[model samples]
Target: MAEHPAYPVGLRLTGRRVVVLGGGQVAQRRLPALIAAGADVLLVSPEATPSVEAMADAGEITWARRRYADGDLADAWYALIATSDPEANAAASAEAERHRVWCVRSDDADAATAWTPATGHSEGVTIAVLTTHAKGRDPRHTAAVRDAVVEGLRDGTLVAPHHRTRTPGVALVGGGPGDPDLITVRGRRLLAEADVVIADRLGPRDLLAELPPHVEVIDAAKIPYGRYMAQEAINNALIEHAKQGKSVVRLKGGDPYVFGRGMEELQALAEAGIPCTVVPGVSSSVSVPGAAGIPVTHRGVAHEFTVVSGHVAPDDERSLVDWPALARLTGTLVILMGVDKIGKIAETLVAHGKSPDTPVALVQEGTTAAQRRVDATLATVAEAVRTHEVRPPAVIVVGEVVTVGPREPE
Candidate 1:
């Protein structure tokens, strides 16, 4: 018989009976999709894998605990014949034919009435790929094609500009801690859909280069004690763009709520009667330290980790941090934006009873190619910072947990 192209069609199996003739790896892989489609799945096998048995125990599917019988496909809308026994598989496939049910045979696709394509979904789009040749069918080729399409859709490389749904609002997207790939999927998608982007200096800078020419990239960088953009001005720009019915993305570094001033922007938009969407990103307080091979908390080493902003010195009147209380806690302390004030911070912690010998690590430009770690003690960290010419935007980790992981990169 000559091989022919398979006509692909989606099966709406909701509330439909799907009889699976095996409880092995093949059935384990396919059962989830069937269950997700709301299919009433029935498993017919004398023995089953642990995963398949768990599914039956959970009532996700019915298990007969027996071999494939003649009447097993009596009223099944779809059948999957995947038993280890070839004779049993053939019998089940033949029974499905008599019942006029669509059947898929795992052992012999050419003999089955249907074939499952390599399927994937992204951004509300389903990608299914089927590769057929006169010689044979290549499952790997089908999966590769499906993966490519799904990835392109997810990253907006395959987006149709004309088909885009223009949502006119301000999105406070966390671009994650320094790394462009660390940004959330929704954040990246929102950025691709943005007409106006107000970005910070600390956020993922590499992603900005990927934006289309039409996107207006605004520099809202708040450089430390240097040339900077005011928060009020950034808020006004977000409001102004959103009022013009444009999609605005306020791309910030790290988690928006984690000392990112995300709520301030959200509140400003709310007062201006503009809608806002907030997409959270991985916080640098933990991720940066982890990138430098330091765990903020370790068993029997540090029981708790505290994240604090060190933009202000402990003696400064504007500082709200309780230095005395923080020093008394037997845990880890992670400070952000405190490189310049490290001298005063170290003095305050040591004076407040924290040991001068407490280990400290400064991770600069963490998770990026420029990442470097500088180690010191509470008494020596201030000098270490000055000696190394360490700059702001570095995460300062204090306490014993700093010494719990692999040695800092040279």
Candidate 2:
């Protein structure tokens, strides 16, 4: 007997009754997607995985807290027979057959009426791949194919230029702590669709090389106290490209809001009536220290962590940070863009009653191959930076938390 090819169709399970006959790993994995589709799921099981229990507790699903019984599939538009008991699974399958409800069996796929596909979503498109023939069923192969297609679409390798509609706007994407892989999925997707990308030198630089040659890459690197692009110029570039119906991406380092001047760019776009999207990134404040095996806050070590910009000297009239108050707090302090002014900042902290022997760590180019950690104290950090030639774009950690992690190679 030859198995015929299965017809593929998306089930609109919204507000529909769905009966699941297991609360184990299989149900835990499948329940979220079902719930997301607005399915009124009822699970019949003696016990469930902690995650499944959490879902039930959250009122996302109805849990029977018992084994499957007859008439469980009476009004179910769909059913999943995945109970540990083979007899229970067989009975549920038979009930589903009698009721003409499509059911998927985790144990015996051949006996099931439905097959779940390897699914993924990119942009606004849902990708689903299923092996149709019973003899040729290969879940791993189907998943691999799905992943390849999804990755291609996400990285802009698979182009549907003619069929795809272009939206002209600016996307402020956070590239995330200098790691190319750390960028958010939404940020990466927007980059794939970008016509003009204004990039920073501090973030995921490797991704720039992966962009198609057609994309105009503009260097908007704001090198600290060095050669850099002006903020006004960057704002103008974003406006100009967007006004020309180009999808412009302002790719920045770390979170756009976390000292990235993202609001300035947004304000400029708003003034010009250009639509903008801001995708948050992993901030270097916490991630950089973590990358160096240092936790920003540790139990019984530091109760609070503060992130401050050190671009301005504490004595400068334009400085907004209250150095004296920060010094008084017995917690971790993370300073960014403070390499040049670290000596002055450290002096101010010590003068304000902070211990001069407070442990300090300078994580330069954090989360990248060029990353290096320099250890010191408030008294020695100024010298450590000078001796080590530690540059800007580094995160400086001050307090006992810096001593909590494994020692960096001397």
Candidate 3:
């Protein structure tokens, strides 16, 4: 091992060029920030998930749909290898070393020079939690503990350095779920540095308390049944802020890409030549139900699961989902935005093969302190919701999984 010298305290990646050599979730999670930090990111991987592919398709990031080569690192200021294969990541790490540029290996195994510390961002001010999670122990567990400590600290600390220096153009955020406390450590840091926050309406307002008292807030949400600002407008605003050299937060509800339009907005920023990054949030569709005493999947109840949207047109029969196939699948189905269409949806399910007696539940504002849940069967769900006057911002769990809930403590 070689001795590593201390580098500058604030050598950020803004306006630099970074090469990311992977296409799955890790790169997807990190790519936005690289762009947000004003880095011209070039992605080199054999495959890309839908979101990553979309970013590439939109030309937000340069794409090389092949394995990493020595020259792939050319003109690169930093390199990140996020491939599932450890060997490829090691190779990329080696290439970065030869180039004497910074590198972060997502695998974080042997031979990598640097690690992606637990970090958070809001605006351009970032707070990073550095820990010696050095090998052998669980990385995720260490991150969780670190984040707990970071969250407890108020936002006032970032002010001294922030006012003296230009805000770094990178933010590493952690998007908490409906419960604000679930946020990661680094997520807390970035929120403290933010000058403005463009957040989802559901991202636990209490969590925003960490921001400095004067931070600007914008509610650009597309919550079901509730009015929402158009996505184009939100993207334009984020880009404009960054172009004005202002740090901004594109805060999102869940992991941002779990049907949160994160990719769309991110692409818009890249196309507009604005900088960006992403902090993952726990998805409420699953976490919410689990927290509400309803298991969306269970042994014998359901062995398979699929999450689909209920926001489609009412009678666009041709574009509607295959009701018969879904009914025959014998698994759990989680429908987002299905509160208003329960009766017809249930009828469609039964008309195919789902039994009219199948168990169902409507979970509203799940995982929040204000959560409410009502249980019934396919035959009774429509009436149950109507009688209770349940609104949107709800998730419907179908199949026998809804039958497994708290037993009143015996």
Evaluated at residue 336, the lDDT of candidate 1 is 94
C-alpha displacement of 109 in model 2, angstroms? 0.8
TM-score of each: 0.93, 0.88, 0.59
lDDT of 3 by residue, 206-274 (tens): 767667778887776532322435777777677767777777877766567776878888788778876
User: What's the count of clashing pairs in each model shown?
Assistant: 0, 0, 15
Off by over 4 Å in 1: 162-165, 222-229
Model 1 RMSD vs true structure: 2.7
TM-score for candidate 2, residues paired by index: 0.88
Q: For each candidate in turn, give its C-alpha RMSD to the true structure in angstroms.
A: 2.7, 3.4, 12.8
lDDT of each: 0.90, 0.91, 0.72
Which residue pairs in candidate 1 have backbone atoms (N, alpha carbon, C) closer than 3 angstroms, thus clashing? none
Mark the 10 consecutive residues where model 3 has the least summed lDDT.
Answer: 1-10
Predicted model with the maximum TM-score: 1
Candidate number achieving the greatest lDDT relative to the actual structure:
2
